[model samples]
Target: MKKRLLILPLLVITVLLAGCIGDGTKNMEQQTELKGVLKLDGSTTVYPIAKTAAEEFMKLHPAVTIDVQQSSTGEGLVKFLAGETDISDATRAPKDNEYAEAQRKGMKLHMTVISNDAVGIIVHTSNPVSDLTTAQLKAIYFDGTITDWSQLTNGTKKGKINIYNTDPKISGTAELFNTKIAGSADKPYVAGTTIIHPTPKMIPTIKDDPDGLAYTPVNWINNEVKMVKVNGVAPTQKTILDTSYLLSRKMYMITDGAPKGLNREFISYILSGDGQSIVQKEGFIPVT
Candidate 1:
């Protein structure tokens, strides 16, 4: 009787082990092994989110390699037009010229809205200017005036305003500036100490220096800097989604053509609930 009981226990153990092995094998086989390298490039505004998505997607599909590169929006469009990348992370939709170029090359762009983010005007925490009128912001950055903090208040006892911005040649944020501030392509930047580069660079410099001011996506704003209110309205998720914020934009994922493989899957994942969770945690607003 004892021997029979022992044999029965051994049989149960063997069955359990077999079930585990079968599940493991099935999981391995069910995984769509993405092998070829996928390339993405575009707006620095969209770069961090794209890079994060690529990293997470690659972990599930170990055979896939996603390469994310930073280029300003216009340059990204150029590369996409040249067929250098499979994906383009853009803060703005492709322009008419870009669409014409893609059509000429027999490539169609597949656009997926990733998130809604406000473009925040940031200043060093030390700056007392917590709110700025849109006219003041335009005068400071686009009209080439408002060179000093004192100038912002019409000769108050404030220090000089150190202005920084992303290069208009490469950034969609700059394009926004051109539209909202300059109202013309040939309009010059508001006069101040210009620190022009990518958005990544602009945000950091503004944070580290107490006298500096710059603009970037709200997701990028942290305790390191303070977001200045525009026309008495603050840049926040509530303001952006409600269309109350003046400095806001939509982020997008652009594919060279109809997406396939991990690229398609990854975008789908971002649009899914799981993906939007990451977006919110990362300080960006989910498209949904």
Candidate 2:
């Protein structure tokens, strides 16, 4: 009878231990299953980096879904203000009005500098002019002060300049250009200039036109279009990282407040070494 009682106690203890182990295993599984949807929207210029990082992050956590959208930076800020997105990507810093709007909603906005990018002055490959000063760029795009290639090319070229610009109301690149070159976001582009939407369109638009000129992020510059030197310095990763390039700007990912849970993890991953590698591969200078 004593042996039977001792055996019953041993069985109960074993079952209790097994139950504890099972609970622990389930908890571990729950922790390992990183399941959530991450919504990202913002600058098409910053899209490549966000997309690449999203892709890599998903590989690490299969249950996580990231929906990345390409809209102009201004629109992204609008969505963020509406509490529709978890993250907003921007090629420039948030404007005062953006901060005010977020504050009006009682939401705390946090901006993370993810990368450094340069505003590239692009032209057709055949264009003989290889460089432009900040003054020349400002006059060309802002004041319409320089209207023809002959004015810049010293009579070597004779044609009306075809200036293109991203819509300042929507595009972060245009806002950056306006603020950096023209000294104000309220400043308008030169009259008669064509306004493009996404930054990528600027590449082919300039490539096909012999007299084409536009400003875009340096990553978008390809062999089809030649990127002109600004202030006697080319927009290289080194120059941009060192802040020696005249047209460089910091890229950002803004959250509503201090990132928590998966949002924190995702942003942490992006700032990590692996994520910065993707940044460099995507042709932007890593913040690190």
Candidate 3:
């Protein structure tokens, strides 16, 4: 991913201008021709955007092929470093150890920011708790200082808390939650916790478990679960963009080095019109 890549003028086809008034077949006639199979994996959170991009991109360049997989960020980076992937979608930057390993292997990694996202603190809809301070979030998720809902609700909702989180070992979202909110990842997690994988499942798990306290990507929030405020700020698009929400963070697409050839073109395409549109529709804040 290169700096200024997003703003780089795309090879805008006049057919796209014609699309405002043309039929589908007319737009197809003007598709840019590129040939290659792009392999993208990692960050199930980013899969929605990447998958949609791949589908739409292939439609334009019929000869180009793409395969996208929804694995955790760490898992994707593992394959990326091992030469198994063309790009790794991530919710957080590579860890220091990963950069060191890349240096040892003489691999130069490049990062391109794609969109904005936030870790959403959530609980079952039936729960009365609505807000959690950063201190309280850390206390509940990492320090074991707060375990029961009664501690936050003043005995009005008295129950032992059931905590849920994606495994920090494999999830960038979880790592972001622990490192950003909890302030560290080395500490031991408290007991009575259910560790999930892939982040999105935290939704249904918390939705069904009335006493659960959990965090997940904001995109996953639905009517089944209730999102909790961090400090006094709700995780809304405006709040994420202004970064008034403490948990907001950027989404990234990583490459082995400064991208070139089909890779560069594909990444550049994402930063442009159609790609950014997909990002916003997929529940991410467009970087553009």
| Model 2: residues with Cα > 4 Å off, grouped in runs | 1-19
Model 1 is weakest, by summed lDDT over 10 consecutive residues, at 184-193
How far does residue 95 in candidate 3 sit from its true spot (Å)? 0.8
The model with the greatest TM-score is 2
Give lDDT tens digits, candidate 1, residues 1-288. Answer: 999999999999999999999999988976645676888898887887877877887887788788999888889989978989888888877888889999999989888889988778889877778788777877777765576788665554487777787766667887776666567534667544575677756667887887788887777678888888888888777888887888777888899676777678878878888778778877889998
Query: What count of clashes does model 1 give?
Result: 5
Q: Write the per-residue lDDT of candidate 3 for residues 67-161, one digit (tens) a residue.
A: 99989998998898888889999988898888988888889989999899999999989898889899998888778888889999999998889
Estimate candidate 1's alpha-carbon lDDT, on a 0 to 1 scale: 0.79
175-224: candidate 2 lDDT, tens digit per residue: 87888788988897878999888888999899899998999888888899
Q: List TM-score per model, in order.
A: 0.82, 0.92, 0.87
lDDT of each: 0.79, 0.89, 0.87
Q: Which stretches of candidate 1 lie over 4 Å from their true place?
A: 1-34, 154-156, 191-193
Candidate 2 deviation (Cα RMSD): 2.2
The reply for model 3, stretches above 4 Å from the true place, is 1-32
Clashes per candidate (backbone, < 3 Å): 5, 0, 0
Model 2: lDDT to the true structure: 0.89
